[model samples]
Structure formats: structure tokens, C-alpha cells
Target chain A: MLRIGLFVVTVIGALVAAAPLIAIAGSNPLSAYRALLQGSLGSRRGLAETLIAATPLLTCGLAVAVSFQGGLFNIGVEGQLVIGGLIAGAIGAEVSLPAGIHVVVAILGAALGGALWALVPALLKAFRGVHEVITTIMLNYVAFSVSTYLVSPGGPLVSKTQPSATEKVKATAHLARIWQPTRLHLGVVVAIGLCAACWFFLYRTTAGYRLRMVGANPTAAQFNGINVRGVVVRTMCLSGALAGCAGAIEVLGLHGRYFDSFSPGYGFDSIAVALLGMMNPLGVAAAAAFFGMLRAGSVLLQAKAKVSKDMVTVISGLVVAFVAARVVLERRLESSASRRDRRRRDG
Target chain B: MADVFSINLVVSGIYLSMPLILAAFGGLLSERSGVINMALEGEMLFGAFSAVAFTWWLGSPWLGLLAALMTGALIGAIHAWLSVTLRANQIVAATAINLIASGLTAALIETVWGKPGVSPSVRKFGIVHIPLAGHLPFLGRIVERLTVLDWAGLLLAPIVWIVLFRTSFGLRLRSCGEGPEAAASVGVAVISVRYRAVILSGMLAAAGGAYLSLAQVGVFQRNITGGRGYLALAAMIFGKWRPVPVLGACLLFGLADAFQFRAQVAGVNLPHDLLLALPYLVALVALATFVGRASAPAAIGKHFIKD
Candidate 1:
């Protein structure tokens, strides 16, 4: 019941956040809501598309959430994801195997790629005391370049002259849609399973407890002999792995090739999603889906409502701005509550 | 050939070094005075965009520079008001400023120019010939053919060094950054000192942004800073919070950038990403091998309030 109440509040918040999009769409606010609901969840096709869109975001949000839970901001998830995609794409270009084994390699390679990208920043933070936020941001740019170099036209972007992607990752490597003509594929299952796994790890495991304790207070954790530095490194690596998986899924299941600059700032978006979801794996999952719907329906909204496609960014930016401006939010809520209290007292 | 290249490399180093110097110097001032300013990049972006727009409009690069400086100062004052005065979390405030700047700037570009990427190239401030040095030897060869701003930056090095170390006012400012409580106890108005430091940082970062637009690239692009602000932050760290090392770190980054630029020009089929990633990789290497046990100011980021 508590979860349901929180979910409803967040949903309303999302709608309120998307108000600017409504104005841009030139449709009445209520009509925009109806269109969004009908377009994303009202039909089986819409639901599947939303699920597909949610897959990478869900995993990426969890990746960010897990790291933030450990008090380490992981902004390199985009970079990690890109590296993972490159590895997956490279593997995809090589051998032929049973689809299952091929998928396993793709996922594994991606996880490793993300983890490796994160390792540098993790080491610097642990050993040299450099801020991960700064390091991770710089790494993101490097990741962008690395992926572009790997997948450019002369490289993996063009194997032959058809202007198609790196020769279709052996037929076995493809993550075919589970539902025909829908974007839904094997990755959605993985995303949900991983979310469950994260919830259990954070709430039920001893290792997770140590991480939480360390995240809350490193000095106290150190006094208690908990290896704070070790936890920081491990959590960051784990976080990067999940983020890398997001990239891998996008490549293996959706696009089937490593594309240069594929992400539209997923790493930064995940920051807002993780925070809005209160850093709960379940909440992050829900938030990711909510974002997924917005993204999936945005194309339709733009076409039918005559809105510039960029309205979605404005809406997302507003949501992040509102959430981050917690001081302003708290003050508004406080003043409103006090006014009500004054009325009650006088009455 | 490599020597000429190396000389050109060092010249590019000096060129790239100036902006980082400006941004890092700004960051140091804000950080030293107890504010963790992550909005340095945003301040630069604000400067970069304004500089381009002003240059396009007025055709005087100096006017563009002035616009950038003001934009940077405005952002700094906004940050100081929210974080320093209102006691908001400095990181959160800075992040908000960054986001707002990004979205608003892009939106402004779309509305104004109908494009989301780089602005039109303008004739900007660039290499200037020093009157007598061009006629002289090795030192003259290096120093004579430099940008007006390049000379200003080298000029600023000792000026800032003296202001920070030699003067009583500099002592009071450092006191505000190092230990506000100590400074406050001694009757220094810690808040005002910090406010001034941050404002100065914003102004310098803004000027650096203008340098990027009006001098470096001569055009504005979304995210044109491309992690330079963080690079500046890294330099600030590697410099151990001092002016000389700050300049050195910037020069190192500039050298890396110059090499990458030359390598790309040579078209050696070296992955562009490797070149793009060079500065960050060098930063990590520099921090790991070079900087040893650098300690930040004691009261950095802790807001001091007299109860």
C-alpha cells in the first residue's frame, strides 16, 4: 500500500512534469494525457514498445542507483555502456554459435567492458582521492571517442557497401523479438531479474549491509574495520557492469551493431531517474518504465500534435530541475502546510 | 621536423594552457573560500556562447569577451546567492546551474540560430606578433609570436601568485578557504570573503569560456568545453591548490591536446577516440604518478555560520 501510494505520487509528478510537452503539442493537457496513455499502455503494441524502451533505461537506472546507494556518483555509465556495445559488436562480427551461447558472450563481454571503463575512475577515487564525478565525466568523453573510433564507417559501421551495419552479427547472435513486430526481446526479462537481484543484494545480503554502512559513513565504517575502499571499488565495478549491459542489450537486441554516439545522454538521465525513484531498485524500475513511455510516445506525439521533437527534453529537464531543487520543493510544501495549520487554529 | 613540431606543440600548450589556467584559477578561488563549485563548466559554456553571439553581432572580439565575463559573473553571483547565502548544498546548486545553463543555452541557440551545433566562425582574437621578440633568438621565438591573451595569462601568473601569497588581503582570503572558523574568530567576514572568491572564480571561468569561443575555436557548440572544466579541476588537484603547478598542469593538458591535434592532422589511422581520450588518460597518469598525498584546505565545502 505504501509502495502504491508512492507510485501514484511519482506518476502524478511525471504528468505535471510533462505539462510543457502538452503545451508544445498544442493539444489540451487532458488530451495529451489521454494520447500518452493510449499510445504507450492502451494497446499490446504500445505496451511492448514501452517495455523495450524501458529495458536499457531500467538497467542503467539501477546501475546508477546502486552506485549512488554506496554514496559514489557513477556518471560514466554512458561511457561504460558504449565500451560494452563495442565489445558486443566486435564479438557479434566474429564467430557463429548457438543463439543462447552467442547472447551469453555478448552480455558477458559488455559487462566486462563497462566494468573496465569504470575501473580507472574507481582506482583513482580509492587510491588518489580524486572525485569520481569529475573523473567519470571525463571518461564519458573518452568513451564517446573510443566507441566512435571502433564503429566509424571505415571500421564496424560499414563492412561492405550496402550502408547496413557490421555484417549482421551471425544469425545466432541476434536477440529476436519474443513478440512479433514489437520491440520486446530477451533483454526485458534480464532487466526485471537483475532488478530483483539488486533488491535482494542491497536489502538481504551481508555484503550489501557493509556497503550501506560504508556509504553512510566511511570514517565510522573504517573504525568498525569494514574495508571502505574495497567496497567503493567493488560497487563501482558492479555499477559499471550493469550500465554496460544496457549498452550491450541495445546493440545485441535492438540495433545489432555498435553505432557511434548512440545514447542521447542516458547516463545523465539515469541520474534523475535514480534520484526520483528514491534509489530503490523497484522504484527505479518503475521510474525507468515511466521514462520509457515518454520516449516511446514522443515520436507519435510530435507527428500528431505538431510539437518539436525536443519537447521531451524540456519536460525531462523540468522534472530533474524540480526534484534537484529540493530546498524549493520543501519550502513550498512547508508554507502550504503552515497556512492550513494557521487556518485550522484560527477557525 | 619533430623539433618544429615540438615547438609548435609547446605553443599550442601555451594556448590551451591559458583557458585551463583561467578556469582552474577560478575553481581554486571558489573552493578555497569553502564552496565546492561544480558549475565551472556551465560558467564557461555561458561565456563560450555569449562570446560567439557577441562577436557575431558586434564584430569586435573584445566586446564578445566582455559579454562572456558578465555571463560568468552573473552565474557566479546566482550560485553564491543560492548555495553560499541560502545554505543549499553546493554540489546540488552547481549541478542545477549546469543543467539550467545547458538546456537554456541550447534552447536559446535553437530559437536564435535554428541550429543545435556549432555557431558560425567569426574572425576572433588569435596569434599576435610581439614587436621586438620576433627578431631575437630561442626565447624570443617562443615568446614573441603569442596571442595578446597568452601574454596576459603569463602576466596573470605572477600577478595572481603575488596576490595569493604576498598580500594581507590574499592571506585573509586563504584563511576563509582553509578554515573559516579560524578566520571568523580573527574577525574576518568569512561569508563576504567566500562570496568574493566565488564571484572571482565565475568571472575567470567566464573569461576562459570567452577565450574558447572568441580565441580557441571561434565558434560555440553545445558542450564545447568537452570536460575541460573537470580537466581544470584535475589540474587544480594535481597543482596541490597552487598557481605554478596549476599552470604546469594546464600546459601538460595543452601539450596532450596539441599532440592529438597534430596526430589527427597527420592522419596516421590512429583511432580518433584514442586522441580524444588522451588528456583524460594523461590526467589519470599524472595524478597517479606525480601528485603525492595532496591535502585540500581543512574547511573546504563546510559552510561557516556564526550561531
Candidate 2:
């Protein structure tokens, strides 16, 4: 009950905080919210778009949640996602295989690519005690540079006709569309399955138990005969693999090619999703869906209310801030309630 | 190579390093006081946006600089409240700050300027002629062309070194960071000192933002700091959290930046995107080699809980 109440309070606090900003942007807060609801949930197409947008977010949120569970901050999810997309895109365009196998190979290739990208930071963190935060963030810029170089005009992967993009993924490699006329794809199902699998792996597996032990108390875990360093490296690689899948899904399902600057900070947003979800797999799914609604609805919010789509970013940021402060907020509420109870009894 | 060694290149390098220097000092102050200030990027962004907005409103660059400092202080207070008072996870809180700054600044750009991505150019600080510097050959060319903020950024290092190492307050602050419980036992106001250090850190970072908008670029673009704040954090680590060494680190980054620009102008056979990644690569190398847990404040990132 307390968890539910805290979650509700966090959501409300974020919205309340964002209302004034909406007003300042010359829109009535109520109308802006109405537009957001209408655009994201009022139509079938909107709902599908919400799910489509939620796909990558869910996967990336799982990535973040896993790392958090292992006591690692994998801020390089953005770069990992990009590397995954690049690798998947290259495989999808160049490799020839049977239909199902082609897509599978492309995605697995992406996971490998992301894992390789994360290996440097993971090893550095495990052996040298270098903080993963700075290294991962630095690598993000490197990833951008690499992607841009590959797709730049006259560059290696540049498409003949399209600017700053690789050739489209082969038809056999494409993630199948599920809902007709709504642009919903099979990637959403894959994402949900992945979420369930992550939940199972985290709760029911020995490796997961070991990872959690390291996260909870590395010294204690070491004393208990766990290889803490090895766990850290493996946890980071697993997290990077999930992030890579997010990128692969985006390319194979949504964009159909590797485009330069494709993501609008989905990887960064996943950090907030993971936090707000309390670093749980199922909670992350719900949080990602909520953010997806905001993203899907923002188009109409912009068109109907003249509020910029960037308002969604502001709202997400506010939600994260509120979530970060949730422990204090909960304590304040409990203390105030107790005080009120005492006053009533005395009276 | 010859062009890279020119006086003009050195001046540009100094100019490029100014924001990094200021922000690195901000990180230094906060970390030295036991607070992990990963929000330097966010604070700098807030400073950049507010400087542009206030300058556009009031039609004066000086006021813009003032506004940036105030905005930065406000953000610092918020961060301090979350990380210090509430005892929230410092990294998580800082992440929120960064997101808020990025989002709010981007949204407000549309609201205030009727556009997105970039703000209108405002009145910016012009060159300041140092007394008798124009008469000197190489030094004159370098010193005479700096803006007021550039001069401030250059002078702040020595001033910070003195304030950190020479004063009683500095000793108290260092004690608080090293051992807050011990400091409290000795009658030092640990909480208040941390609050002041974090707030001052914010002001300095905001001044860096002010330099970006009011001095360097003369306009605020969306996400204009572009990971320079992270770069500043890297520099702080590379310098082992010392003021003079941090200043040197920033200069090294600045020189890398200047070299990138010169390489492009001289038609060096490097891709522009790779060139853009040079400073970050340098930072990564620096961190991997120089930083370790031993160099950080003993009690950094630990929230104080009074008994």
C-alpha cells in the first residue's frame, strides 16, 4: 500500500510541477493535458504509437534496471544502443540468410556489438577502479563520431540515394508489422517477452542471485566466495546487450535503416524510467509505457495547444526529480500524519 | 603544424578553455566539500539559457551574467537540498538536474523566442584591453583581446588555490569533507559549510555558462555546453581534485580543441566527426590513467546524518 501511494504521489507531483511551466508556455494546463490524453489514448492509432514508442524504452529500461541491480551505472547505454543499431543495420543490409534466421542474426550481432563497446569500461571499472560513469559518457561521444563517420557523405556505409544513412534492411531481416494501418510491429511483443524473461532471470536464476549479492554488498559477497570483479564485468555486458537489443529493434522495426542521430535521447530517458520503476523489471515496463504515452501525445499537444514537444522532456525530468526525493517526501507525509493523529487523540 | 604553434592558436585555446576551467573549479569546490556535483553540466546549461534570456530581455550582457550566476545558485540550492538534506543518491539527483536543465532550457527557448534549437543573439561582452599589454609582443596579443569573463576564468585558479589552502574556512571545509562527524565533534558547522560550498560551486559553474553565452558564443543554442560539463568533471578527476592541476588539465583540453580547429583549417586528413571527439577521448585516457579512489575526498558522496 505504501509503495502504491508513493508511486501515485510521485506521478502527481511531477504533473503538478509541470503545470506551471505549461502555463508559462501560454497554454492552459487543463487543455494541454486534455490534448495529451486525447492524442495518446483517445484513438487506436495513438495507442499503437504509444506501444511502438514504448518498445525501445522498455528494453533500455530493463538494461538500466539490471545494471542498477548490479550496483553499476551504465550511462553509456546511449552509445551501446547506437553501436547495436549500427551493427544490426550493417548485418541486415549485407548478410544473406533465411527469413527468421536473418533477423535473429542481425539482432544477436547488435548485442555483441554493444557488449564489445561496453567491454572497455567494464574492464576498466573491474580492474583499475576507474568509474564507469565518466568512461561510458565519454564513449557516447565516440559512438556518435563513429556512426557519423560511417554514414557521412562519401563514407563507407553511406547509401547511394539517402543522406547520412545506410542501405535499408533486407525484407527478410525486417521485424514483421503486427497491426495493420497503425504501424505497430512485432518488436513490441519481443520487448514484452524480454521484460518477462528479465524478471525471471533476475528472480529465479543463480547468476542473477550472485549479481544481486555483489550489488548489495560487494565486500560481503567477496567474503562469501563470489568473484565480485567477474560479476561486475558480466553485469555490465548483460546490461549492454539489452541496450543493444533496443537499438536493433529501432532499426529493424521502426526506421528500417541505420540513420545518423536516430534516437531522441531514449537511452538517457531510460535511466529515469529505471529509477522511477524502483529498478524492477515489471515496474520498468509500466514506467516506460507512461513515458511512451507522453511521447506519443506530445505531437498533438504541440499542434493543438502550441506547447512544444520538449514539454515532455520537462515532465520526465520533473518525474525523475520527484522520484529521487520520494524517500523524504514519504517520510514527511508519515510524520505529519502521525502528528495529526496525536493532536486528535489529545483533543 | 606551424599554424598550430601560432600565437593566434594559443589565444583561441585559452578562450576555449575558459568555460572548462571555471566549471572544473566548481566541481573541485563541491567535491572538496564532500558533495558529488555531477550536476555541473545541468547547472552550466541553466546558466547558459538564463544568461541568454535575461540578456535578451534587459538588453545588457552584464545583467545576463548576473542572471546566469543567480540561476546557477538556485540550481545548486535545489541539488544541495536533494543530495544533502534529503540524503538522496547524489548521482541520481544529479541526473535529474541534468535532465531538467536540458528539457527546461529547450522548452523555454521555444516559449521565449518563438523558436526551438537556438535563441536570438544578445548583447555580449566585448574585448577588454589590459593596461600596457598591447605594448608587449606575444603577451600583448594574448592578454589584450580577452573578454572580462576570460580574465576572470584565468585569474580564478590562483585565487581558488589561495582560498582553499590559505584560509581557516578552507581548512574547516576540508575537514568537513574529510571527516564530517569529526568536524561536527569539534564544533564546526559541517552542514552549513557544505551548503555554502555547493552553492558557490553552482555560482562558479553558472559563470562558466555566462562565458559561453555572453562572451564566447553571444547566443544560446540548445545543449550548447555539449558535454563540456562532463569534460570538466573529467578534468577534476585527472587533476586529482587540485585547483592548479585542474587548471592545467583544462588548458590541455583547450589545446586539443584548438588543435582540432587548426587541423581542419590546415586540411588535415582527419574526419570532422573524429576531430570533434578528440577532447572526450583525451579525457577518457586521462581518467583511465590518473584517477583512483585514493585521490577523492575521504567522505565524498556520503550524506551526513546527525546523531
Per-residue CA lDDT of model 1 for A192-246, tens digit only, reads 9999999999999999888888888999999999988999999999999999888
**TM-scores of the models, in the order given:** 0.88, 0.96
Clashes of each: 1, 0
A1-347 per-residue lDDT for model 2 (tens digits): 66666667887899999999889877888989998888889999999989998899999999999999999999999999999999999999988999999999999999998888888889989988887888899899999998999999888998898999999999999999999998899999989999999999999999999999999999999999999999999999999999999999999999999999898888988988888888889889988998888888999999998888888888888888998788787778889999999999999
Give the alpha-carbon lDDT of every model.
0.78, 0.90
- lDDT (0-100) at residue B14 of candidate 1? 80
Second chain TM-score for model 2: 0.98
Which stretches in model 1 have alpha-carbon errors above 4 Å?
A1-50, A153-158, A161-165, A297-321, A327-347, B1-4, B126-129, B267-269
- Of candidate 2 chain B, the 10-residue stretch with the lowest lDDT total is B284-293
Task: Report the Cα lDDT for residue B221, model 1.
Answer: 80
Chain A vs. true chain A, TM-score per model, equals: 0.87, 0.94
What residue pairs are clashing in model 1?
A: B32-B177
Question: Model 2's lDDT to the true fold?
Answer: 0.90
